[model samples]
Target: MENAERKELELFAAKMRRWIVEGVYCAKSGHPGGSLSCTDIICYLYNKEMKVDPQNPKDPDRDRFVLSKGHCAPALYSALGLKGFFDINEMKNLRKIDSFLQGHPCIEHTPGIDMSTGSLGQGISAATGMALAAKLDGKDYRVFSVLGDGEMQEGQVWEALMSAAHNKLDNICAFVDHNGLQIDGNVDDVMSLGDIKAKVTAFGWNAVEIDGHDFDQIEGALKAFNENRGSGKPFFVIANTHKGRGVSFMTDNASWHGSAPKEEQYNIAVGELDAKIKELEG
Candidate 1:
């Protein structure tokens, strides 16, 4: 990617981080750590990778994205809003009784959401089914899904992976946000997802691991996936990221996983992201 393009993406991701903090703080209940960690990848996908149109959201041939780790709806919602799916200000109303932006994605209500996903491991299955349907219908759209590292413990994710490979869903690309910390604590302490890359490769998919926050790695991984198309297997990218990535106090902190920040913390997060945005913009 060009330097200018990379800077633009960095700025966009920083804005998304601010939106995540704003939404969660306003809701007083929602996940922010993982949401912030995965913002860059989602921003890159929506802004530069996916062939999605806010104007023609239901276009069948458009690429699909499912946030398997759905509590991170704040990130997804921010991306969708910035992509012109809805008024970006609606993000501040997150989780409100009258707001369309719920705690988790609601496909029926949200314009950009391809699937309603909140259950830990179910979104990947839905993404796999979408890819299979595309193949069956001789369509060219690709399906993408993002999963939390902690979510790796769910057996259903493995089942979905098995099905994706067995069905030869090469059009599907899945990302495991290996951010180490979950709501409880370290993922290893909770349940070890030993050798995630090896496990995915053994499941008969192409696997690559990268630094989740690095735009170059993120872009390279996607390009590599495109280069490897027609290989008759699904693709998986294990992205090593820090929980609560952009905020100083929240980084790698398990307690921030599902908690709303207090006023002081929220201000600090916004301040940090603002400075980062300015740095990138310069």
Candidate 2:
């Protein structure tokens, strides 16, 4: 990516982090650590890569994305809101009573959501089905999905990967947010996902590893996926990321995995993110 473009993405990601923290802090009941961790990848996909139109979100020919790790709906909703899918003010009402933006994504409520997701492993299955549908219908649209590192432990995720590869679903490109922390604690302490890339490659996927926070690497991996299509293999990206990426106290802290920041902490996080955004934008 060019310097200017990289800066723009960085700014967008910063704003996403700000919004993620703000929404979770207001709700006092949603996951912020993983949401903040995956904000960059989501921002890049919506802002630069995916051929989606907020004007016509249901456009069949447009690319599809699934937040398989759906607890991170704050990030996805923030991305969608910034992309013009809905009013950005909706973010403040996250997890509120009868709000469209719930704790998890609901396709019926959200304009840009391709599938309702929150069941950990089910979203990947839905994404695989969408990819297979595109192939069966001979459509050119691609499907993308992001999974939490902790979510990789679900047996259904591997089943979906196996089906994607066996069906030769090259239209599917998946990412694993390898932040290494889950709700209870460290993913290794919970259940070690030994050699994720090797396991996926053995299942017949073409895998690429990259730093999830780096715009250059994120853009490069996405471009490489597009350039290397038609190889008859599903693509997997292992994005190594920090659990709480932008804010100081949250970074790699398991306690922040699903806890909302208190008033003082929220101020600090927003202040940090605003400064970063200003620096990047300037």
Off by over 4 Å in 1: none
- Across 1-282, the per-residue lDDT of candidate 2 in tens digits comes to 688888888888888888899899889889999998999999999988999999999999999999999999999999999889999889999999999999999999889999999999999999999999999999999999999999999999999999999999988999999999999998999999999889999999999999999988988899888876898899999999998999999999999988899999999999999999888877
Task: Put down candidate 1 lDDT per residue, 67-102, tens digits, no spaces.
Answer: 999999999999999889999999899999979999
Local lDDT at 39 for model 2: 93
Give per-model TM-scores: 0.99, 0.98
C-alpha lDDT values of all predictions: 0.93, 0.93
Q: List the residue pairs that clash in candidate 1.
A: none
